[model samples]
Each structure stands twice: as C-alpha cells, then as structure tokens.
Target: MKTKDKIMIFFLTIITFGTIWIYWNSKKKNNKKNELSRSEKISFDINDLILFLGDINNIQNVENTHKKVKIYIKDSNLVKTEEIQKLKGISSTLVSSEYVNIIVGNVAEFLKEELSRKMEK
Candidate 1:
C-alpha cells in the first residue's frame, strides 16, 4: 500500500479504538453512579439512627434477637426516648441508653421495599 494510504488506515483504526474506549469508560462510570446512588439510599435510611447514637463513635455490637437483629452503638446517651419510640413503630423495637441498641427484624426489608418500588415503574 502507499505510505499515505497506510497512514490514513492507522489513524482511522486509532480513532475507532479511542471511540470504543470512551464509550466503555462512560458506561462504567454510569454503572458506578447507579451503584453509589443505591448505597446512598441505604445509608440515608439508617442515618437518623446512627446520629441518635450520641457522641460515641463506631458500632460496638450486633445481636440477633429471634427474627430481630439488634445493633449496639458505642454511645447511646444521645438517643431520645421519643426518637426510640418512633423507630419502634417502624420496626420491632429500638432501645437506647449510654449505648444504643436498635432491633430490626429483617435487614432485607428495606431492600425488598426499594426493589418493589422500582418494579412498580
């Protein structure tokens, strides 16, 4: 082939590969964004309870109480009785003191609820 023709072919090949790479990268970024959104939803769902745990940092313990699971936070003193009562209405029960223990019977319940909402669309 002529030098000019070979050079043109090479440039075209490079452009094609570059376009494919860009498209793939964009798709990956979108997937990551979707995953991040889902993660944020889960985090937001538990944010209030986490904050109510008080100044103490970190989750101390988690226990299964029958079908319910209890999460004990390091500092429970920050939790208010009214807030605990509201939480109990949402799930099985919520107990808070110097350390907070929240009982959620089914962790998957939130995910299931979210999934069903999505499926409705």
Candidate 2:
C-alpha cells in the first residue's frame, strides 16, 4: 500500500483499539463501584406504620396497634418465618408460605419502586 494509505490505516486501527480499551475499562470501573458501595437504608413513618430496609434486612414493617406491635416480613417469594424471625426487627412473624401481595398496604407504593430500582443495580 502507499505510505499515506498505510499511515492512515494505522491511525484508524489505533483509534479503534483505544476506544475499545476505554469503553471496557469504564464499564469495569462502574461495575466495581457498584459492588463496593452498599445499599442505602431508608426509613419512613406514616400514621402508625414504620418501614425499614438494609442489606441484612430485606424489607420489613412494624405495625403498632392499640395494644400490640406486629412485625411482617415482606418478599416476592415465600420464605420460612424461622429464618426471617432470626433477623433483627422481626420479633415475631406469622411465617408466610405465599409471596407478598403487592396490593397489600404493608409496603408503600413509592418505597417498593425504589427497592426494585436498587435490586436491579
């Protein structure tokens, strides 16, 4: 090939490789950052209901009634109460074999969306 054509091809090849290297390294760095950062805990109270969630704590609630405070472990899949009760904040769980109902009032709508976003990451 002519010297000018050869030089142009070399520059193009270098540019392509450099771009690929930069893209791959950027993606790896972003993934590493996500792995290193922990999920943030969120808390909010409306009326007599309380909500709390963390890495160790999936999703839970403490409902205050006239005379009793009840705990509920909420999840999309059925989980043993014994395993859930073992976690802090879940004093006594009814132990459900059914997946949590999204329509249920235990989890507020906005918080559920936020949790879903976090889990996606």
Candidate 3:
C-alpha cells in the first residue's frame, strides 16, 4: 500500500529469488559431477584390461585388494603397461619383478573374480 512497504517487498523478493537460484545452480552442478563420475566407472572394460595384462594365458596369478588388482604374470615383459594405465577406471599401474599391480578404483574385486574364472577355464 505505502511506497516504503512496496520497495521493501521488492528487495526481499529479489533476495529470496537469488538465494533459490544459487541453491538450485549448485545442486545442478553437483548432479552433473556425479553423472560424469558414474560414466567413468561404467566405461571400465574387463576384456581390455585382461588383454593388456598379457592375456589370460600369460597370467600366472590374479589377486584383488580393496582398491588394487595384483596380477602375477609368467613373463612381465609380455604386459602392455602403458595401455593398461590408459584404460578407464585405472588410476595407476605398478610393476615389480613378475607381478603388475593395477589401481582399478572400485572394480578391483570384480576384475579379480573375472580373471580367476577365466584362468579356470
């Protein structure tokens, strides 16, 4: 009704809208980050990893830790270390003597199980 009351209401409305917009924008950005991370996880390919580990036949033993996959190969020279490090979900690669340890994020357990099964058959 009064001019002062109208001006106050307008400023309050703008502040409320601004707060809502900032909150919504932050939430949207977080969702997008989550989606990108999920996509990265899904991009992991066990077949490619196995191939880079010098194939199933070359592998002497496969072990999985919480966040790493330790693969013991008959001949470490047969492994393609560079290629294995480039695969999705692979954080890093470590080579020691006859074993190669791969940091495969959360998929290490799954990879170990798959490799074990392949070795059996």
Q: Pick the candidate with the highest lDDT.
A: 3
lDDT of 2 by residue, 1-121 (tens): 8999999999999999999999999988877644222222323332112222224144454433322233345553434434434443233444343322222222334434454444455
RMSD of 1: 13.5
Error of 2 at 110 (Å): 24
| Model 2: per-residue Cα lDDT at residue 24 | 97
Q: What TM-score does each of the candidates earn?
A: 0.37, 0.29, 0.63
Per-residue lDDT of model 3, residues 14-81, tens digit only: 99999999999998887764431211243567788778877889888889777788999888888898
Q: Which candidate gets the maximum TM-score versus the true structure?
A: 3
Off by over 4 Å in 2: 33-121
Cand. 3 TM to true fold:
0.63
| Residue-level lDDT for 7 in candidate 2 | 98
How does residue 1 of candidate 3 score in lDDT?
100
- Position 58, candidate 3: lDDT: 88
Worst 10 residues of 3 by lDDT: 33-42
